[model samples]
Target: MTTVNADAATPTELNVLVRPLPDYPDAERAYSRSSSLLWRRSAGAVEILHPWTERTISDSVMVASLSELVELGVLSGQEQFEDAAVQMICSSAASEESAWRAYYLNSINELDNGTSPFSPVHRRARSLIAGHEVLEVGCCFGFFALACARDGHSVRACDISPGAIDLLTTASASLRIDVDACVGNALALPYPDDHVDTVTLIHLLEHLDVQDTTVAVTEALRVARHRVVIAVPFEEEPTEHFGHLLRLTEDDLRLWADRVDHAGAEIFTDHGGWLILTPHR
Candidate 1:
């Protein structure tokens, strides 16, 4: 019978009695093997022969096995922790949020057949321009302009990008949506004073610099006889990213609206990233 000395064995010596299965390979096999060999070489160090073979366990062996199992579990948890940390760092570096937003916007435009994501903006613009002429600033590809024209409103759309203007013109011809689409700057709008019944500025305010934004707003006011519908991203805080030239908080919009109202424009506030200012006719 093999002499089982439970009291003489340390935790490390008892751990040697249980070997991991051979089916799953480990990258640290060399280190593990070397450590096992060093422990086995010691004199009076509870010899664990054929540790891979199943055998009945003494109380000491059972206690040692339990301790070893706990240590292994801790080490495995640590490895998982490290892996999760690495993944988080990689995600932060990749700017995943911005990528997802861009992907969502592109997908919506492609899947929705060139409709604006904000339906409220579309509806409000249509209502404000019902049986009236409208001008759209920064009308890239003329989606909103075409929508208004299709609804029987005379539409004039302008964009800074020549390519966008050309695309808008081609689309107009194909859709048979009569629209005056041109390439023009918002700061120097190519329209006479009090010409249009409504001016629509969708997602345009945040792109303009301070001077340009003021000038563009003034130009829109000058061109519109009735109302100017403007929409921008809801500003929670000032952000350098997202092409935000100047973050317009609700307070900022109110202040500007007051100025426009003083200039004979009656500003109407609407929730959901939109503001409609009707000029006193």
Candidate 2:
């Protein structure tokens, strides 16, 4: 665990919430186990834990008191952070056992919200772009990419998953958002040097191992001419086998930003897991 900086601003408060699935025993066990580990790690340190249990392992943690965490970071605004954290918890839980497909399906099906949990961060990044060409690595279902395109920014969305790319393309067409979606990898971006004005990555960096993350950051710098926007989950403790290679903290992100800055790029944290890095022209 990274040591908290005494000189830096401290988090405001911490809270936790839990919800148990009665039908899914395996899920309940997994959730309980993971939540316990997190709680034990974050105990009595400006954090709150919420546990929801139905049958066995009824004592389990579900949601977190995120506002305090944000306050600790010297950030304000609660509703957005709360929403993002819940979505992240759900996404992480679902991803624990290949639940992303179901999660994505449910998100798309329930479009009544128009704004997914990532909407706040996505909207923030979109607001920064004043009609610029944007590139999204690992676009998933093109949710954020489509949002950018719909906002009148030309977007090139790419993902290693062909099915994801196809779905994004199809969805973009239906929404009348002009976007170029492709199948590609983050390490070897399928774009020319300095081709895009902005590069947006949501919950992407931590998906790779440390070494791979370094390589991907290099590639993102290589392709992006102006800015790089990234969002990661800010968890108190490490969860076992988060489907990806590793989990990251603000320190990790700061180190990555330093690397980019050494390479002549400027990095800025946009609260929580969102970062905005701009390269020198």
Candidate 3:
């Protein structure tokens, strides 16, 4: 998918939200098998998906201490997800497709339902925007994109996952927010140099395999005219088959900023490391 730049000289009008949704055949390959919710605090024990309500997930701090940023249209708002997830496990008969769906359903709700379990990425990026365009790479379900749009910034979101880009675009329209959502590669972003004021790779860089390391960062820097923000789990223990590829320390971010001749901060937080970098003069 392609983004229709609102400021393009020709002044073309595009209704991306009205476009047909992307069918994610790649979901099974992109899904995770292992569970990340063994000890997460919640209002109740595992239950079915259909009857579970949003209140069920966020009402209790046990699930997550944080509240979502906006209301989610996905959940039925009735039961505890844990029980429903197990049903999904059995319904799909423990197949890879079932595992992937269950994983995404849990993960998407975690971030998109107006609250996020992760933090520190937006703390500094918001201050630096100063009314500039924003690009969110790996913007799964576009929760943060919605937050930026809510804060009155023009936002564009991209992910390699066609399903993600399409869903986020659909949700933006439903919320009456204007945003350009598209399929983009982190290693070779489609944007031109200095195209956006700021670029964000929140919890994204570490997901790349060992070999694609520098390309994602280099591409982010190439596209940002003012600031580049990167956040990753600190001292992360790699997950099996489908999660983080490596752990990152403050020193790693410092070295990355130095490569661009820019000064940056290595903010160590309980949640993660938030790295904010600026362009060289």
Best by lDDT: 2
Which portions of model 2 show Cα errors greater than 4 Å?
1-115, 237-242, 261-271
| Residue lDDT tens for model 2, 151-172 | 6788999998796797667656
User: How would the candidate models be sorted by lDDT, starting from the highest?
Assistant: 2, 1, 3
Q: Candidate 1 lDDT, tens digit per residue, 1-281?
A: 11223445443333222223332344243223222211131353222221221222221222233323323331123223223222222222225333223322332243234233455556665666624798999986566787788778899999997966876686676556788989888988988988888898877878787667667777888888877878777666433323456677666567667655424433444533556676666
Candidate topping TM-score: 3
- Candidate 1 regions with alpha-carbon error over 4 angstroms: 1-116, 237-242, 261-271
Candidate 3: TM-score?
A: 0.60
Where model 3 places Cα greater than 4 Å from the true spot, the runs are 1-51, 54-116, 119-121, 128-130, 240-242, 261-270
Q: RMSD (Cα, Å) of candidate 2?
A: 12.1
C-alpha lDDT of candidate 1 relative to the true structure: 0.55
RMSD of 3: 16.1
Candidate 3 lDDT by residue in tens digits, 1-281? 11222343221121111000123333334322112121111122211112122223221222321111001111112232332333433233235344343333444355444354453345445555634699998886676776677778889889998977876776677666677999999998989888888888888878887557567887887888888778877765643222467777777666666555554544555467777777542
Give the per-residue Cα lDDT of candidate 1 at 242: 30
- TM-score per prediction, in order, is 0.54, 0.57, 0.60
